[model samples]
Target: MDKSHQTKAFRRERVRVGVVGVGGFGRSHLGAVESLASAGRAHLVAVADPFREQHVELDSRLSAQGVAWHSTLEEMLEKETLDAITIATPVPLHFGMTRRAVEKGVFVYLEKPPVPLLSQLDEMIAWDEDFRVAVGFQLIYSEPIRFLKQAILDGKLGTVRSIRGGAAAPRRQSYYNRASWAGRMSINGEPVFDGPMTNALAHVLQNILFLGGGDAWSFARPTSLRGELYRCYPVESFDTSCVRGVLDTGVEFAFAGSHAVRDESPHTLEVVGTRGTLRLTGGTFSSDIPGLELPQHAGSDVPMLASVSRFMDYVCGQPETDIIRLEDTRGFVETTNGTLVSSRGIFPLDARFVESYQVEGDPGLDVLGLGDLITQTITTGRLFSENSAPWANRTPTVTREEIQSAVLEEWIFGAEENPKNATACL
Candidate 1:
């Protein structure tokens, strides 16, 4: 094709994209958008962030790129001509902001745990039928995970029996201190329950759900759940969580995660079935199935950039399929909500169990044997309570209705129905 024709074709396919919250994780989104724009897959037209002034470097960079900046998402939505918007805002702000963008007829690429509450997730799911929406469960789009998903469907694992997964990673105090709602159980009566399961190891949980159902489009909803939550630091939500549940399909699921571990362990998910077992951790896959050959791969199993580019393609109607769907996250979301409801309020650990550390001049907390605790939970398919932990309370029997009640409490009342003894998290 001639140069003019090629240029015109590129312009015809380029999607006009804006990013909200151009700081912290939002900066990562900006980098991806900018990369795509340079390649003519997208046009980064605008950026929105209330804290743009605080991030002078990010502000100047966007300005140099000729992208307009707005203080709030609403302002950006009103003033900018955008075909799509990527939301990397706070947990509580996700649903409302994404809703506004969707209502404006703009596609959305939202950050993880799409929204804090199940009710909000449901609303987004309903709106998804009419809008192009992609959540940040980016691992689903990774080549390795995609290949493994296909293997499961090919009966590589036979009839799946159970799944166990865990992520034990330490976080500095700066992580919680980053925002007013960070590590909070609720902010001004609104649920902002951030913690290990929903934030750090959340991708692991989502990957487990995807594996349980044998595909990206058929994630399994938890039939029931029992778990324990703990906070070793002075936070509102639990920094450590161990949960066990059964999927509606009768496959067992158990997960444990902690932000209080001393060292970062490779986040792992193990799928056990009648025929064989498959384990995935840190992009390494191993299986015991006879004749199974693991693919040789390098680079990240995390597919954030790929997901962003694919989302832009999806928005432009070039890719007719959604590699990641908002509805697929419902099972993970409901199970997380059920964990919160089934547990007695978050239990703060005795100070003796917590040791202080400093990471690059930032304060952090480490729970003694957090790694062991998580591993034990995964191995035994039990929660901390089920293992006879000295600090854990007996997990309550939780009904799906109880889960809905907790969600409704946040929707109507905005905070935990009973928050007196709850520990903050993230």
Candidate 2:
């Protein structure tokens, strides 16, 4: 992940990529990939999704090239020799699918939250310094987020004192009601935590790390976590929750999220500091606000566009940017794991303060733009403690595996199952 390494090109002739799970994000990813392929930048070969209906749309849209469709994801993986797969499955399936993809040595453009559990993250990422693998953290692809990062760096906001974020949106029970896996924590077990944190506003923690200097392991810590399941959703108690914490750097941040808000427009971010403040009232998708510019790309995506023009460039390899490294992912995942800790009660004070950081000047003048690559810059080295937490009066330690293995409360995948006390890991 050095400048000299960035100088090396992971170029190819044509990126013969495949698409998996063409439901929501998959279709969008396919659009971008297809556009790249049609311009001869990348090749869109095939797609896989459980829903058969997904096939008709892509088949109609992608032309006769190599657009094979499959009802099951495994079948697609087994049948096709693909360079990569754009995975947009539900949150629960993210880990399993991404692991399988990397296991097959297929580079993966996996949709975000990386995986629900940190342990699941360890299972998927390839550690070899030789092969090429990528995680699809599309939030980084948004163009305007880049602008915010740069603006902060350029001192547009002067000194970033604290950041407060909110994502309040109502998801009809229908949305969670339609799919068996919608609000559940495990594809097999009950729902854990709430619907929003893992489901809707997952990026809250993500963008926080990006803004507060990425890599939560070294730079992040939870001072206090107070949130409610909101007593609304049937699946789990918390459909909404908020927490306040200090980055290891002591930068205070407040995060509030809810899947029950029911608003025509949802999502907003405002960072206050010494000079001025910036706010993204409606996220990248646009809202009633009207004038807010948006980002087209985000931190995690900058590298993909930088040197990658075709599938071959990917196959031959391009850069060794560990922008999406397992460790970097662990930074966020460990923090996610800490969320479970908060639920259990006593949150810990990490070993040291997070190193203070600032973005590199202009994230982009445009409010809506692909965020700067500064997010990746934060992980240029180890950002958090990888060893057990031996620095506390009560040095209790938690790993990603613990979270993945913990028994989730009993619940249904898409529906509720009657039960008093149940423990299962979906």
Candidate 3:
């Protein structure tokens, strides 16, 4: 082909992508793509949903827009040669789909819960960095969250003393009822309830680890818990919770989430240091110590956008500054894992209840895998399952090795580099 023809072809095939699952979140993903793709920011190549007939809007729009459609993820994978995929499928399918795509050399913009098993995560991390894998832990991507992270790295708050955060959101039975995997321990065969710590509150915890810890937060220590804790139908998973925990550096963090509430309150936090404090409300950034408050927005962008953009930029080989490194997420992931253990009384900051409650069998769910799996299980029944963690009751503890590996990964991903000096990343 001539140079001009090749250029035209490049333009024609600019980063083909596929989205699996078309539930509310899937619909949101499609909408975000539409906004960007029409402006040439993305190319909406195809979408897959087993219930295409139920979603008249999605079906008609895709058909009318000339975007191809598939009834199942495997079908989409086989029929369309895509550069990347935004998985909107169940959590159980996450590992399978993501592993397949990356092994096939396709970039993957996976939803939260990027497979919970550390072993699985390590294997995925082993993929050629050439095939980028971006997780939807979007607290790092939130404009306000990012700004706060900058503030922490700037040392405006001094050595971090503690983190206190809570996400008070509401969910109806309709939420789980509408989706097969909803509120279950596993959908198909994958474990569900990656927990509020990993799912709804993941964005919050991700921010805390990145902004407060200076990207060296691989170390994690779960403190303790309190209040209204119960797993709903599926009774096998947590439905509502409130817990208190502390990080390795003695920074205390709290979690409050419930599936029974009728209304959703704000998800916010206050990061306090000896010098001052930082506050985040609805993903907005502000700090009393730094003396800065970012322009607040009326609403936060869907968490997926930040990660999606990150995936795209990385896939295009954008400069390091733009990428959300894996190491950064390691802190986030560790922090999340800590919360799960803490909440369940498996790992205790207080140690008061260490022997009070008999913890159940190990779910051994990777928090990330659980979140994606929960999302998937909730969205679909027969997809997104991973093996349970047999050690849930074994007491949660992080080896120095775990934290080190997470930090090392973040360093490689530029999460630990001085935010201002992106080039110094590991």
Candidate 4:
């Protein structure tokens, strides 16, 4: 064959990939892999999900695509010599599944909120000898966020003073009811800490920590954290939280997240510096610095696709330098664990301040004036307790070491009981 034809043939040698878990967000991972497969960048070899039989349409869809299905990851690993696997399983299952894949000498694209605890993360870091694991903190791959990080390193945001971020995406009772483990701190004695900061809106926190890092590839570890956690929903975990802390780099940071709000607000991240400030909201960036020009190209409209493509690139021999390695997320896990420990426990929000409403036939609980509280917290870079919310109480700050050594079950099961007489306002 000619030189050009030889190059084309070589390019067609795609990385073989399998996806574990094909429900909810897992389906998104499957779709991204399929997209890359269609482009000759990857081969979607197989997928594993014990609950696959329950999803008939999805089963037929996969069948039609000539993709193999396994009831478990063990079966998939035993049957296929896959190049890599993307794990989109529950928070508790991440570490175990990643460990299995690593043992089999396979690369892993672990879905985010990497794990529910720091100890689990440390274990993964210890055994991932070849740097074969990549966590799916997709926003780190976004053009705007990438541009922002480089700008910080280049002294565009001179002497970065602080970073603040907040996100308010309201969830209804149906949301928590979707799965047996949803919103639970533990399921069947396993840590699943499915709260806003740790689960649904985790990208915001991850981005904040990533931006706070002194270097481009590093994430700033939290030295100390203080948090106020409250739940309007009757779940084991909090529905609303406000965390304030200091990064190891001495850059102060604050974040607020909630699933108990009436209207959805854009996820916002603001970085303040001595010279100027940069603000990112709803995937767009703005700044007070005159003549600051960001990259004209927009990031992928589908972040998961971008993340999967990048992982495939790494699997197909690209440099690992840009990948979100497991170690890059220590700060994120530390912040998450510390926030929970600092809160002592998730408080039950007073029913007097909580209103019940139907959003498209789903029962949703909204904290009265929560939108205002979220705005105030983000604007002032303060925790909800410091902002004087009637239901808010400040918990003592906790150190990273304390968080690492803490037992999650002690806090998960030891929370104050909900008031039986309290009823949501209609």
Candidate 5:
């Protein structure tokens, strides 16, 4: 084929794409698809959201581009013949939406923490026989993370020893009030398990497991986990957590996170090896390795955009890249589930240890000395209980098998009543 023919063939390989959900993080997905569409790499065929009419400007703008809007994913799928669809719905709706797309033989770019429960994730994995679904752990697509993973694999970090990561970002009362399911263990009989370790700061936890894996493209499965779950805010689920565990490869890992802190700290990870240590904060990395550097992307540095582009390339018949798949997230699901079981249940922190403050006209809580506690945990690879937090509970360790067989209702409303139904106290 001549050069002109090759160029024509490339232009004809655009993937037809649709997006589900358009609020909050869903807007980011819409923007990514639009950007790809502008580059002639994809066609933004349609979007579906229950509240599609709420965003008047967005609806008009997308409609002007010949994009269709629907009140449900079923309608969108029935009318549009899409090569791929991005599912950005709520935690509970992910499985049903993905199952619909899968039934139609459409590829999917599922949002992070794909499903709240391991069993639901397992069902998705079973349905995805053709390996067409890509879980959106955007950081795994970043150049810095990719470089760091490769460095660990190439022995640049020496023998991997331990991994620790944490983030302290305060969430106002309005944050949890924005949705019915926010900060809840379960909503209407479906597992949401919304919390720092599973929802907001989950990327850091997932990345820790990803780097701890034996190979470049796998996540280390957790064999056992010990954790403490606490809530300073009036939410059914925890706003703060500290979990430590051993991976299948025997590497020890620790993570701490909170939505009850006074100030925000950048999400950071530390990988300590025999010869040197590596640190990643946000998009940048600093290490003890001589002259080590991160690669640059030709397009945007945003991880979400990079992830969307990679998935679109795969849909367009490019060779399969090492993008995250459904099977790769088993370790993450196991760790999340295990943390809940290990803690027995989310403990409400003593009111005396929590102080209320207003941030930007929104009511918020600051757990006394929580910033230092998080720092201590991440630095020493210790749980809050080990660090001697006065209010911290020493919970027993739980195995992955126990987590898999555990019942959700037992965790939420076992012998103890739902903490949210009572006063906030230890």
Candidate 6:
């Protein structure tokens, strides 16, 4: 009985689900689970979080739901016989937690970035033949985005020439202070790999990839990339990133993101093609081509809920549909990991370019010329290095082969590859 060929028996009754990690973004996963419960598509049988008692409000809310809780995941798993589980744990915990659930034959809805390292992702994908695992890239599940995808496939926008996407959101020091591992590249010598592009503004990056074609593996893979990573805040990882590359399909892709900028620009993904252009800004989609009519959808489900519901549908024997399986995100994992591997060293801005300010009575950091840089890269489809940003390095390049080599050596041969020294071999 090969594990790849093994399939979990479909549960005909209401699928019983559980969630792990109920803090930070976990609350969003819970809200989506509650939506599933309300719709009678699934039942949340239990929850697990070691720090639940510290947050009295969250504790009270879970109590109100009348579901059982445990201080640890082991306890919850022992008590509840769940058909599926949604993992909202930290990036460091994702691989192990999801692996345990999958080995136990439980279906999983895992949080984004799937896993921090490429080797970990490869292992998970190898065993996910039955498609029991769904990675939570919520925007891909949005009805509007899906419609736009089909429009592109239908040639409504013609051949995509280039893509510009990013988000300009600011985070105060308190955000990094929320957890011991917050904004850290590594915790206790293991990869947490949390940063602006990989975590916070990940949706923007993935949207650009998805818009290119198929899933992350087939459609969105970049042939080559140049990235400028900068840190305005005191963290091991960069908070501001600008990346530009050409996908294997030859479509140009550019992404700019920051947690240091002010609210000067709306988050957006604009696709430019030979025939027309399509833009998604602030959750609404519009295009320059006239007479583009989107079919009306049943009111939108909170992206997380929509994803959870679809996973539940699969568990209940619903015929296979176009859900975002874990393997579909290989291209995304490669891109993010490549960005981080290339962005290994912390290039802090000069004191003159950094501005200290009070954001909601909390300390914040902003770079003087970041906004213009963001806009310029998006407009011209150029990497920061090409645009001659003063802070950018001399021709910083990140290749897929380099990343794959480092990750393989680290994860397989047990060699400690220095992620920060990505240019050492070069």
lDDT scores for all predictions?
Answer: 0.77, 0.50, 0.52, 0.83, 0.83, 0.74
Residue 326 lDDT, candidate 4, scale 0-100: 83
Q: Give the TM-scores of the predictions, in the order they appear.
A: 0.89, 0.68, 0.70, 0.92, 0.92, 0.88
RMSD each, Å: 5.3, 12.5, 13.4, 4.9, 4.7, 4.9
Structural RMSD, model 6: 4.9
Kindly give the number of clashing pairs for every candidate: 7, 59, 26, 0, 0, 0
lDDT of 2 at 351: 13
Ranking according to TM-score, highest score first:
5, 4, 1, 6, 3, 2
Q: Flag regions of model 4 displaced more than 4 Å.
A: 1-12, 294-300, 413-426
TM-score of decoy 1:
0.89
TM-score of 4: 0.92
Candidate 2 C-alpha lDDT tens digits along 330-405: 5466555555544442122221311111124211111010011111111111111111212212213333345455
Clash pairs detected, candidate 6: none
State in Å the error of residue 390, model 4.
Answer: 0.9
Residue-level lDDT tens digits of model 6 in 1-426:
122322456646588989898878888888888887888888988898888667798777768978888877777777889888888888888888887888777888899989877888989987766668878888787766677677777777788889888877788788888888777777766677677788888888887888886432234777677666776677666778878777877788989888876555667778888888887777577778777775555226466777777777877876454457776687777777676556555466555666777766788777677777777777777766577777666445677787676542232122123243212111
lDDT over C-alpha atoms for residue 25 of model 5:
91
Model 2 lDDT at residue 307: 24
TM-score quality measure for candidate 5: 0.92
lDDT of 2 at 197: 59
Question: What lDDT is reached at residue 269 by model 4?
Answer: 87
Q: Tell me which of candidates 3 and 5 scores higher on TM-score.
A: 5
Name the better of 1 and 2 by TM-score. 1
